[model samples]
Target: MFLKFLTFTIAIGGSALGGPIDPFGSSAARVLTQLPEKTWLESIAVRRNGDILATSLFYSSNIFTVTQPSVHAHNTAKILASVPEVNSLLGITEVPGSYDEEAFFFVGGNFTSLTTFSTTVGSFKGFKLTFPRNGNPTVQKVSDLAPFSSFPNSVTAIPQAPGSVLVADSFVGAIGRLDLLTGQYDPRAFAFDDMAVPKGAKLPIGISAMRMKGSYLYYGNPSTQSIYKVKVDSKGYLVKGAQPSLVANISSVAPGLDDFIFDPQGNILLATNSPENAIVHVDVRTGRSKRIIGGPTDPLMPDSTCLAFGRGILDTNTFYVSTGRNISDPTTSARIVAVDASLLNYY
Candidate 1:
């Protein structure tokens, strides 16, 4: 989903400090590249070699690549691939066991219009992309998921089940499983009332961002303004009796949440609370959260959408974030920023 629901704002409170925390020496957030105006950068994934793959929503639905994002000179993102027929690309995740080559799976769909946040209902599809060492990258359609899904927003790999990933179907309010090798898709693989959008929401967004940690899946529910998690079996199905538990309540920080990435130790969850235009760190153990970077009035990362950690040793402490071009204004441009995560003391 895009910024159509951005008009619904939240009151800034709780542990959400409304000022920028400049712990990275002088600059609080470093802008690596800026896209053209009206581009909404949706989801992000980091390659094994530290390249960043970011998907853009609206018009072209282009996936861009940023190599050597740590460097500050002339670091503009270049187009890598564009999913045809769809106007937007939402969720993207790397295949866990692809050791010989870098492989990824992504979801795309057509919307009612460029400015509308609703999808065309039956226009969703999934694709697989592979980047080999010596040749050009290739992308192929893997599944036609529109029949069983309404809106697929985010994706995460289930390492226990190789070649299988769980897709967050936002409008359907469920987490689905897609098998890349067998072309099998189950739209109701995991569903709970907690994942549903509240009876009357400005936007019918349900499950947005999702990440798998060990045998559990952590996700954000924008409509509920909360984060929740549940245990899953080896096959990526929700455990028979496992109930979703509260991870945190972020209603005070932002009206909704978008996408998030887990810290290296898995103890912290860094999330993009959009519209409110802020990013926060949630402690998984205590459900305590604090605004670490950007804010409602902060120009650093306006309309922040998705986040990902750098892949290399030197840049592992640094994470990259993408912002949506302010949908209400035509002059605003989307951006990709590098944030230093070393200042976060999980203890």
Candidate 2:
């Protein structure tokens, strides 16, 4: 386990020293909407009706909705609902078999500050939110992930495992299983040695982003600047004897990857946060990564955090990304930018 971590660290360190490569420049994307200055938009999930649901990273743990993402001029965001008592919100994903197709699960906790990574341990929780066509939306506490998880950052639904979703516990370097039906959680559902963070690290975040594709579960670790996947069973547990395989070490392309999404063709679009605010397009077959939009100093996408594909026919080819504060200039508004996926043809 130590050998694997050291090997990846060396590979990433070498590539990071080579500096970043930005091919698309700043014209490939445009800001769809933005929140007031100092508001940090952390995670984003698109609704079935084409609206974008975004979570606050440092704000009031409020969830906002940006309607008509494809039409920027007509775009405007309004506070949808705020999780009661929680100080910050992190990861959120839609639950497949819910009423009106508007049900979602999110993670939130009390954080002293994201800049300091000071989390109020044992305060993390998993919540379920839903919006009905004929009535108002509601937020409910689903599972308490404390006493085991230190920092739960991202969540993804298991299609084959109903009423269950996997949560990425970043600080603990583990993947947890949360049961929505029973409100029970197993913090070490899929812990691996490769997910460990080195001692006394500055930003000790592990398993930052997670997603499910087919029978495999893919996740990213910024501490290692790499992505990996493992096969899982119908029960949402990692298959016995299944080993995690490396998808890519993206350090050279961006400082570190925060979150990523996959297209139908199995290609990936990843977001880089903080110092290297950019988007990387990865070709899984060739293992090549290219910067598709933004850069370290691009104001349009000030701290790019997460990306999601737009729903429905009119905007299927569009990708909406959420941005936090401009680390270089905190006074700028956090934004949601739209980039045309067709730009991939030029690359």
Candidate 3:
């Protein structure tokens, strides 16, 4: 655990059980580094070795790894590898215990396939994963296990269950579980049909992001600005008839949802409201939300598109958030912002 910097003070808001933490004034929301120019950061992941991997999908695809200690003495980052000519790289995950028992990284996106990498070798140094084609949609193998079709926009590996992966088919507003060993894509692992999307909510054109905690899988619908929670079975499958519980409803605040992340404590949920161009923090249990950072108030806060937990030196909770003009803007300036996860102060 990274020790909290004494220079930083914690800002508590709401109530301990159902309130929010104010970390805006906390010194942790500092700019860590500006990625290389022309690199539109799309996805980010933190390796167990404390290295930060960021992927860009513009005209081509590239992955950069930031070494520990970050760019500043505050945190460290270094470019590990870059792959060109690959477009639409969207999601990333690290294979547990693959790199020196440190875990390798995996990336998924619009290439008609998926890819993984070993930690020590750098770049596209690992294995290339290919999915079998099933009709019009191209199927790709995840973790060399399950075969899945459709546009897999985001993916998350369940830490408690190895060889198990969760993918969000954003277009269908559905989440599926892939058993790497069996090569089966099971849509029944998620609870979605029960989620209520307003009277006429903009149905999910695609799923943008997903994360797993314990037996629960959290997903975001970018079109409707809603977050959903579903329970998975022992095999890491979504139990049937398990209605999706609403985590947050921000349709009125933002026309589109860009991304969301859970603090280390798993009690506070941070979301980037792209349409309104702001970041909101919500209590995990109560569903109440508060604007901790971002919005038009901060010129540096670009339209936040994606977020990941950044491991800071000395055991601090640092969250790395990616920002862009809009999902369609290929020329938008991209940046990674770091914030103290503990600032939210929830357990």
Candidate 2 residue lDDT tens string, 1-347 = 11110010111111111111232334556667657767888899998889888898866677888766665454556777766677899999998765654689999998887777888889988887867766667677777775856789999998877778889889889898888887788888989876767566567888899888877888988888888889987767888899999888887888868999997688788998878888888776667888777787676676789999999687798888998886546676676788878765635
Candidate 3 per-residue C-alpha lDDT over 151-246 given as tens digits, one digit per residue, 9 for 90 to 100:
455677777676666766554456666665554556534535532233454443455677777788777766556677878765566677676788
Better of 1 and 3 by lDDT: 1
Model 3: residues >4 Å from true position, as ranges? 1-27, 74-79, 83-85, 111-150, 181-191, 194-204, 252-255, 312-315, 325-332, 342-347
Best by TM-score: 2
Instruction: Give candidate 1 misplaced runs (Cα > 4 Å).
Output: 1-26, 344-347
Q: Estimate each model's TM-score.
A: 0.88, 0.89, 0.70
Worst 10 residues of 1 by lDDT: 1-10
Q: What global local distance difference test value does model 2 have?
A: 0.78
**lDDT of predicted model 1:** 0.76
Q: Is candidate 2 or candidate 3 better by lDDT?
A: 2
lDDT computed for candidate 3: 0.53
Error of 3 at 161 (Å): 2.5
Error of 2 at 96 (Å): 1.6
